[model samples]
Target: MMGKTLVLVTGMVTLLSACTMMDQPKSLAFRHNAVTADPQAAGTAQVTTRPDGMVTTTLVLTGLTPGKTYAAHYHAFGPDSSTDPCASNGPVSVGFPSFTADASGRATTSVSSEMARIAGDLGAYINVHYADDLKVVPVCAPIKMTKG
Candidate 1:
């Protein structure tokens, strides 16, 4: 009887430990918009989480004019998808460095953070600059990030 009781308790503990291990949270994926002034010069970004919690962002820029520099950042919300740009309700959990564009009109970057925190929500987009006007002429919005 004593041996049986010990076995049962051990089994229960092992089962509980397995359950806890399965409950560990995973990283998240992100959707981003590339904003530019040339209606043709914009696109989206897809961010995926790696096992080490670093995020790799794959950016696709279309309609680019070639040989132009763009001042970009991970903004908080999806463009008109939200009411304000600086508001806290959008997706950008943390801000990234300003990026430039190449002749083919594409650029990619990554971040090493959990990206799941409220500070890392980074909900929406990528903004590109036009060489002629030197102002942000395009805006992309409504990007999404989900647990992978």
Candidate 2:
């Protein structure tokens, strides 16, 4: 009767919604913490996965040393998997091209990697290190999946 018809339509709608979700790729974002004396020092990373396993990552940072080059990479740690100091985030999952901050203390770069993804065993962190020494990690942001 009327109630049975309503129930069947709801079930069909739910199934169709799930199918649409499966067809879409995943995306994630990470916000960097201020690790330097400049309280405004911060950064952000946006990660999106393609259907073919390639990952596109974009980084934007501010309040850094002007004209100073900085190295950045993807690390093997999600937001819940690491505990501080940035050293504990594990090894680099993917290395990106170095970028130098502009005179206004801003830098933006986009890179693609076949070994990086928003999910699975590829890890989920975007790490920025000191220009002079890659050993010094000044900004570390763990990627958190925002959409799929």
Candidate 3:
């Protein structure tokens, strides 16, 4: 009976884990842009690479406009500069699902993509923006600090 119970519990745990397929190896901190449109926002983006050559980015945000829609994306290193990926004017490489903050002004979202899509310079940074107004970027999490 004990052995059977152990097997059953292990199976249940595996099933639960399968619901969330991503793994986080390290978390990257987000900083408000010097000329931020929403200075009140804060967050972190955790990037993890799986054995299958897939990447996952999980973002947790705070101090946003409660109940407002927001978008997040991984951006490629741009031509503006070589050292500062965040200020490089990079273009989007992968976009996460749009999400709305709760009443407390907090939100969490994640996106998964094949690693090749955002490898090296292509995954230079991630930024959070107002879904309705892309120009209003509140926070940025630099992945590759320098262009590769």
Candidate 4:
């Protein structure tokens, strides 16, 4: 009887642990295109909600111009409902600080904003433009939300 009770307790503990793991935040991936066929740059971003209700995002990217500063922002979905491609992503939802690539052409930055989590905001995107000219969007990525 004691052995059966122990097994049941262990199973219950395992189930509870799994439930907690499911509550953990998720990360999203973004890939940039030089044109429509060539992959230019890529980035990964994760959104975590703090206990204070502030949402924080950490973004890391590679394949940028060395020693160049770039402007990054979060944009809403475009008018087209079928797709949220980078080229048509709507107005800026959140503007992040400018990032300067290292000599190796890599950058990592963490910014805190009121932007919602992936589950909460499925129509948002991360856009990276030339720092000198915000009008030129060289590389951009749609924030694809996923679960663990």
Candidate 5:
């Protein structure tokens, strides 16, 4: 009888532990694309999990004018026709990086650690510069990530 009780108790403890662990939030993989009005200019981004519970993203922009500079950030929403969605949520702009185009009009950069923690209703995109301001752009809002 004692052995049976011990086995049942052990099983119950094990089950409870498993349930607790399952409740934890999971790491995620995120991806997005940049589509500009100028079909010749567009980009794609892929983010992977890192060991430190952060995400590292690799972005590639193609069909751009070579030797140009681009200012990139994770915006608040996908392609909004009206205003910059990120302007109101200043926190979203933290840890963004700037990338310069190569002779082939391709650029690459990684998203910063702070930016990786952004959750729920967030999007990412790149803006291609024409003059001092952004001329053509591609935006992906409501970025999705996978949970484990």
Candidate 6:
């Protein structure tokens, strides 16, 4: 019994160590949508690729209108502009769950998507919009900087 317990413990530790040793993904920074600036909006997007190749992205935000509803999505390179993915007016590739800012003007939301959905030029950027009025965008995080 002691020998069996020792092996089980060692296996658990090895599994945990392997998980921690996995590569850390780089975070995508959100910037004020220059075309339609929201002086008080900022955030970061982090994408993590799982062992099976599915990717999950979490968006962490600050400086939004308190209690307001917002929507966000991963977008493909649009027809508007090639150089700036954020300004390209892309179509939604994957949408995150709608979220609302807290009393402190901060929010966090996440979405899990298949790697193929956001691969290459398909997932060019992520944009945050007002849930009540989609025309208003406060921040954008560029993923694929250049579109081919």
lDDT winner = 6
Of 4 and 6, which scores higher on TM-score? Answer: 6
lDDT of candidate 5 over 29-116, digit per residue (tens): 2222344443566556565544455656566677656777666556444443324442233224334466777888777776745434
Reference-based TM-score, model 2: 0.65
The global C-alpha lDDT for each of the candidates, from Candidate 1 onward, is: 0.48, 0.66, 0.87, 0.68, 0.50, 0.90
lDDT of 1 by residue, 70-120 (tens): 544455554343433432233445444445566776654444445554233
> All candidates' TM-scores?
0.48, 0.65, 0.80, 0.70, 0.53, 0.83
Model 1 local distance difference test score: 0.48
Mind giving the per-residue lDDT tens digits that candidate 6 earns over 72-143?
999999999999999999999999999999999999999999999998988999999999998889999999
**Which candidate, 3 or 5, has the higher TM-score?**
3
Q: How does residue 11 of candidate 5 score in lDDT?
A: 100
lDDT by residue (tens digit), candidate 2, 1-148: 9999999999999998876665364444334455543345577776655556666778878877788888888766534344442444556778789999899989988888774343533455677787678766667776532212
TM-score of 1: 0.48
- Give every collision pair in model 4: none
- lDDT by residue (1-148, candidate 4, tens digit) is 9999999999999998876655466587876655542145677877766656566777788877888888888776555443544655466777779989898888887777654532234336777777897776756666643211
Residue ranges of candidate 4 with Cα displaced over 4 Å: 1-25, 34-39, 115-123, 144-148
Rank candidates by TM-score, best first. 6, 3, 4, 2, 5, 1
Deviation in Å, model 3, residue 28 alpha carbon: 0.2
Better of 3 and 4 by TM-score: 3
Clashes of 1: 18
Taking the tens digit of each residue's C-alpha lDDT, what string does model 3 give over 33-81? 8864656888888788786778778899998989899998899999998
Residue 99, candidate 6: Cα error in Å is 0.2
Q: Residue 42 lDDT in model 2?
A: 75
Query: Which residues of candidate 6, in runs, are more than 4 Å off?
Result: 1-23, 35-37
Q: Which model, 3 or 4, shows the larger lDDT?
A: 3
